[model samples]
Target: MAHVGVVGPSSADQRELDDAESLGQGLAQRGHVVVCGGLGGVMAAVSRGAAQSGGVVVGLLPGTDRSAANPHVTVTIPTGLGELRNALLVRSCDVVVSVGGSWGTLSEVALAVRTGVPVVALRGWPLPGDPAMHAVDSVGEALRTVDALVRTDD
Candidate 1:
């Protein structure tokens, strides 16, 4: 199964969380694994959705303490790398999906694109001028984009 990383605001609004959850559920239903930062807001919501759909959810945490991770995370990877942990999150996934993100999420998207991983931006986010990157308006479209760009051999 493909691993899809979700990057978004930790303190996003309800709509953003809803979008994240939708995307997570879509990915999970398609048998794709979900990966995230594992805090509250978007990350927590996505983990919840993925777990509920019987999909494995992995959290690439920023610190050593597993207490900060969401309960839905099936695997908690404590990097202790703080913000630099973003690189790990992006690299661990076969496809990257950004849902109503902030600066940190933007950074993750940038890194994923630079590393040649397929990236799908939900809603609207500034990209690093890569033609391989895709921008979609909804969760369904995001999932479709991910499925299309996924490199199975990798």
Candidate 2:
């Protein structure tokens, strides 16, 4: 299965969290693994959505304590690197999905683009002026872009 990293605000409004959850559910339903920062807000919501869909969710946590991880996370990797853990999250995925705007999310998008990894932005995320950066308005379009970038063998 393709591994899609979801980057967004850890503390977001309800609407943003809802959007992230929807995108996560869509990705999981399509048989993709969801990865996130494993904190709260968008990350927790996305993990919850993906797990509810019976998909594997990996969380690259920023702190040493895995207890801080959300309940939806299936696998927790405690980096203890704080924001520097963002690079691991970006590199570990086949495609990156940005749900809401935040500095951390923006860093992931930039790193993904710089590393030649495909990125699908849902509800408008900053692009790095790269052709691999896809700005999709809906979750469906984001899913389509992800599928196109990371083809499934089965």
Candidate 3:
């Protein structure tokens, strides 16, 4: 199973939250691990979905408090790195699925691409063309792209 990181803003809109949750559920049902910043908004929603589906979720928290993680996170690692924890989250995943947009999400996507990790963006930023990155409109498309990128042997 692949380690899939889902990144978005702490203050996300309804659409982004819904999409992130559904993507998390689908990824979990498919046996992939869910990784996130381990706070609110997209991170919380995704963790809830994956946990509800009986999937393992790894929350790389930005602060030193493990209690700062969402209730659904199965594993919480308090990095205390602030925004720099984004790099740790990206590195922990085989591929990242970005739901919606934010400066923080943009940074994660950029890091993943520059480091040769594939990214599947769901209604994310308008980034420069990169072979490792692709913008998708729906969660199904994102899952398909993820399945193709994350090999079974990994």
Candidate 4:
């Protein structure tokens, strides 16, 4: 199973949240591990979806308080590294999936792309055409792209 990191804004809109939730559930049902910032908005929705579907969720929190993590998180790591934890999150995953765009999400995508980790962007930021970065429109496309990348990497 792939360790898939799901990145997005903590203050996402309804559409993003819905997509993130569905993405999480799909990733879980497909036997992939879900990783996230473990706060709110997209993170919380994704975590909830994944947890409800019997998937494991690793939450790398920016703060030192485990309680700050969303309740759906299966394992909480309070790194206290602030935004720098984004690097750790990206590095820990086999593939990074962006449900929406934010400064933090952009940072994760940049790190993953720069470090040779595959990235599947779902309605995310426009990149400069990196081969490792895939832009997708729907949750199904994102899952398919992630599966292809992980299989190719293996």
Best prediction by lDDT? 3
In model 3, the Cα lDDT at residue 135 comes to 94
lDDT of 2 by residue, 19-130 (tens): 8888889889988989999999899999999998998999999999999999999999989999899998998989999986877788888888889888888875555567
lDDT of 3 by residue, 1-154 (tens): 8899999999999999899899989999999999999999999999998998999999999999999999999999999999999999999999999999989999999999999888999999898999999899999999998998887436
Query: All candidates' TM-scores?
Result: 0.93, 0.93, 0.97, 0.97
lDDT of each: 0.86, 0.87, 0.93, 0.92
Candidates ranked by lDDT: 3, 4, 2, 1
- The lowest-lDDT stretch of 10 consecutive residues in candidate 3 is 145-154
Provide backbone clash counts, one per model: 0, 0, 0, 0
lDDT of 1 at 31: 91
lDDT of 4 by residue, 32-96 (tens): 99999999999999999999899999999999999999999999999999998999999999999
Considering TM-score, which of the candidate structures 1 and 3 is the better prediction for this target?
A: 3
Q: How would you encode candidate 1's per-residue C-alpha lDDT over 2-49 as one tens digit per residue? A: 888999988999988999888888889989989899888999999989
Off by over 4 Å in 4: none
- What is the Å distance of residue 100 in model 3 from its true position? 0.6
Please report the TM-score between candidate 4 and the true structure: 0.97
